[model samples]
Target: MHRLLAGFVSANLFFSAATAKAADLSLDAAPMFNWTGLYVGVQGGYQWSKDRSTEFFTPTGAATGFSQDFQPDGGFGGVHVGYNYQFDWLVLGIEGDADFGRASDGFTCCGGIFTFDARKNWEASIRGRIGVTPTDRLLLYVTGGAAFTDLKYSWNSIEPLFPGVNANVFKTGWTVGGGGEVAVTDRVTARLEYRYSDFGTTRFEWIDGSYEQHPRFHTARTGVSLKF
Candidate 1:
């Protein structure tokens, strides 16, 4: 009876030790989440722009002593597509997006004798992204690249009986921004971002005088993407 009791105790100890070791290994060898794939998404938000400064010149390239400032704000919607490759906690990617909306400003100058207006029709960008994953499901990133947009400007003077004149032009420059993304599921992610774009100075020529405008703006948006 003593021998039987000793054998039973020894077997129980051996099984318990083996089970504890297995559990430790299971905890230590868990897999990590990876962010590597192609994705497509849609986004929408509001944008506000500042002209920085404006210059009016005659057809002969001489200054026209007419100066004013304008600010335009509105809502926009867009779509984006991109691909990302991951290295442990770091992620690198490339993305492109296009947005369309109405952002315009109208006001009168010269004692209400002259009416001037500006409108932003659409904008797009191709950017590179660098991000870090602080946790398995959260990512923080910054992006920058080339940007393009269309702006239309109109003006008329009632005192001089001048007809309305419009100049539609495209501007190109650079944009930079940052945002955070959350992995809602294995194949879907949601993100919120903000960007500032500067389209330098563009010359819009009219019959009598030309206008030089510096287009710059701030944008805030949210989007959901599906990974493949």
Candidate 2:
């Protein structure tokens, strides 16, 4: 009887240890998931802009011609904030960002007889981001939304040799882009993105004629973010 009782106690201890080990393994196999939080971060990079000049003939029939090509490239920096939702390996989020930098292009017409200085002071956008994680460490995504820009334009004529003409044009339009992100840690991510924005068109009227133009911008950015 003593030997039988000792054997039964040993079996019970073995079963208990096995059950605990199984429970620990089950916990470890549970799916890892993240999302549903707010995040804010800063970004900096370069922007390339294409600006065009359009001339409108006056009702009195003033002659207008195409101006010089305008292309400007420079650096930009900004901050952004957003909320995200997660479903399995997919993340969907809405974000808002504002950037300040030097974005400008100039146009000269009629052999430098008429010149215009166009500059964009600041810009902002609200966008939606959708990303899928192919693995635990890599994320691929696309983004698009509405954008706004503040622009200043100045023009001067040589024939008449008149004072410079200046106007402040505020434009609202749409933007779209795509990029990729890599996870450096459980809470940190590095990102590279490209975006294009269209500011529509604005018309400026003068004594001789009217000017109609549209301003477009392209940007490439790199940023680091902290995830909750």
Best by lDDT: 1
Model 2 TM-score?
0.80
* Clash pairs (backbone) in predicted model 2: none
Give lDDT tens digits, candidate 1, residues 23-57.
99998897665789999999999999877335566
How many clashes in candidate 1? 0
Q: lDDT for every model?
A: 0.88, 0.83
> TM-score for model 1?
0.84
Clashes of each: 0, 0
RMSD of each: 3.2, 5.2
By TM-score, the best candidate is 1
- Per-residue lDDT value at 119 in model 1: 88
TM-score of each: 0.84, 0.80
lDDT of 1: 0.88
